[model samples]
Target: MNTKRLGTFVAAILVLDAMAHLYWLVRPASDPRALSMAVLNMDVPFTPRVLLPLILLLTTAAIAIVAVSRGRGGWPAKAVVFALGAGLLVRGALGLVWSSGLGTDTGTPFYRLNLLLYTPVCLIAAGSVGLVLARTRRTGARV
Candidate 1:
């Protein structure tokens, strides 16, 4: 895809992720433990304290990506988008390993979701970001 489309795709993903976190924050699951396990693959509480900051971060990332998509922001915005992509790439790679039952427990909700959803989304977002960067570079536009 072109730079604009790719950036929009990444931004949409970030926004959706932020909204998901917001949903968890506002209406926590009846079974917090199960929710946590399904989402994080761990028992850590998905408290407001955790979800709030994460929500903010994801929102900020979406904004940065949008700016990059429009070719409006300069280096700083580009840097944020780059960092976001790199982080997602790392997370996706690790998720793949964990889903294989190497680092994480097998037959768990987290493992299944990571394999079916989270890992693939992250990888796709990361690749789309890379394409945006590349397209912008070729067009002599600031990302």
Candidate 2:
């Protein structure tokens, strides 16, 4: 894929990640359900200290992947994208598993949302990055 298309896809992935983080951050921390879930050790709540820095790291990585992938030599760019992509995929899968077995009850809605729905979104973003990397490699772009 060309730089423009690659950039667009990566940008979209970043936007999706931001939106998910926003939802998690804005949700009421002290909600009775959340606390109830916490009692069961199922729903660990989000703190700004954790979420904000995570967001920053992910954002920086996204930008770096775009820049390095587009700049001179290709391997470095591909490596960055692959590393981040695979990491996200693993994180998302683990998050899903955590969501499934967590909280007061097996049927908690948060579990369904986080594990079932959102996990795949992260995986798809990771897969997109992988696809772009494969394309770059096929084109024989040197790192």
lDDT per model, in order?
Answer: 0.86, 0.63
Candidate 2, residue 75: Cα displacement in angstroms equals: 6.2
lDDT of 2 by residue, 23-117 (tens): 56778455845743633335455667656776776676677567645554355555666777888798677766766584324566656666656
lDDT of 1: 0.86
Please give, for residues 1-143, the per-residue lDDT of candidate 1 as tens digits: 56777878888898898999899888888999999888887788889989999999898888888888778788888899899989999999998898778977778888888999999999999999888777777888854
The C-alpha stretches of model 2 lying farther than 4 A from their native spots are: 1-7, 19-45, 68-79, 95-105
Candidate 2 is scored at a TM of: 0.63
